[model samples]
Target chain A: MIYLLLFWEFFKIGLLAVGGGLVTVPFLFDLTEEYSWFDKRELIDMIAIAQSTPGPVGINMATYAGFNAAGIGGALLATLSEVLPAVIIVYYIAKMLKRWQDSPYVEKVLKSIRPAVIALILFAGLDVAKETVVDWQTAAVLVVLCAAMRLYKKSPFFYIAASAVIGLILKI
Target chain B: MVGLWQIYCLFFKMGIFTFGGGYAMLPILQSEVVRKRHYVTEDELLDYYSIGQCTPGIIAVNAASFIGYKLRGLGGLLSATLGVISPSLVIIVLIAMVLRQYMDNQYLQWMFGGIRISVTALIINTVWDMWRKSVVRVRDYIVFAAAFGLMWCCGLSAALIVLLAAGAAFIPDIRRLKK
Candidate 1:
């Protein structure tokens, strides 16, 4: 029963968490609130782990959440469930892609989605800001991180690693 | 002669360096797939990215799967997808165990706190980057505000947000067609 619930829940995440992986954060937040799968703080740790690790953020988070919720079995089941929709949908898309690629309606819809996707991305940023930054130290850390964003160009490992070291030194 | 094993190994190496999610993979994709292999064209790679964006999944994984499908059909798709995730599966499982064992260690807690703040910062950067690209012109700004307002105020689910936004876009196209 737990396994079934796991698949169903993650499948819903896979179906709707469009525009990439960060978009899944709100859904996972909803899950945390509803179930004892993990708590609010664990969500923070999960995101940290997800971002710092290799692979897609969505898959990594799903694996961590699933492992916590059930076990290794739950991890595999949840990961598979999250991936199934993308695989099937991509297959159909590849088949009919030539037809839809040129459609004005499709272009319009995609164009329209841009603003909405931007909103979602902005919300994801706000959501993280809300959860963290409880005091001056954390606030300072956030500021430093934003500044450090440029040094790495895009990959965040350097920033993440540097943050961990700073935290250890400051005992924060 | 790019064999299945070679494709798997290339993506596996890419997987290890895929920090900060899909956006971080672009440089790797260009150098490895475009420059070194010459298997995937620049245009094809861009198409994979756009299609990956419109599709529901991790953009990197979606693009990898598409490339895999193009290269070697079903088998290639499976190999590439598995290769991409191999690092996550092995590393996360190991880390999860260790983290569970020491989740409450004092230094670890402090480190996590700091890391969380930085992760939050990185996300904020993503927001600014996306905003510049996505929000343009008057209508786009209005939709951006509307979408943001709807979620901030109404607390709508993701499915609903996607539906309404896409629906709003379709209105003009459908109306024009009818006329």
Candidate 2:
């Protein structure tokens, strides 16, 4: 039963997650509220791992969320369901590339989707902030990370690893 | 024609080596698929990327499926898609399994405490980047505000807001097309 639910939820995410990997973050955040498969703290960890790892962050997230919920079987189902939509849509679109590419309808949808995706992503960041930034120490860490990330323009993997080392040293 | 196994192996290799997420995969794909294998032309790779952006899934998977379909039909599509995700599934699950074992370890908790703050910072940075890239036009800002309001004040689901924004975005284009 949980497997079926996990599949359905992730499939819906796959169907609607346009733009790129980070767009899926909001949907996964919604899942933390709707189910106890993984909590918000675990979600933060999942995001860190996914961002730092290889392959697509969205796929990495799906696998992590599923595994947290129901072990290996759940992970497999969640991952497959998440990619099912892409497999189906890409197969058809690949055949008639010119027609679809030139279609005004597709262009309009994409144009519209961009702003909405940004809003959703912003909302997700705030939601995460509310969860993680509890005390002065965490808040300080957040501030420094935000500053460093903006100033440096480094990959996310660097920040995540650096923070883990800091966490161990500071004992916060 | 490239064999299905070869396609799978190449993508699988990509799955392991390419870090820092989907956008990072592009250089590797360009070098391997376009320059090394001649699987697709440079123009075709760009086309796949743009198409992948608009499609409803991870850009990496969508692009892989497109290239695979072009290369060897449905089997190639499956092979490529599977190859791209195989590493993620295996690696994340392994990490999750190990993390679960340390579910109550104090040291692990402290490490994650820091990780959590960093994750929030990363998300905020991502949002900043997205806003800069996406919110160029006045109409786009209106869409952004409306979507934010609906979610924050009205508690509308993200999926519903996306659908409404897509519909709203199409109106101007549709009216122009009618003219």
Clash pairs (backbone) in predicted model 2: none
Best by lDDT: 2
DockQ of 1: 0.43
Clashing pairs in 1: none
* Runs in model 1 lying further than 4 Å from the true structure: A1-78, A150-154, B1-80, B95-99, B171-179
User: All models: lDDT?
Assistant: 0.74, 0.79
Kindly report the fnat of each predicted structure, to 2 decimals: 0.63, 0.78
Worst 10 residues of 2 chain A by lDDT: A153-162
User: For model 1, what is the error of residue A30's alpha carbon versus the real structure, in angstroms, after optimal superposition?
Assistant: 13
- DockQ of each model against the real complex? 0.43, 0.44
TM-score of each: 0.67, 0.61
Instruction: Write model 2 residue lDDT over B1-179, tens digit each, in one string.
Output: 78999989989988775444455465567557876778897546655765676678988888889899989999999999999999998888887877545555777667766766776777677667657766887888889999999989998865577778878875564446788
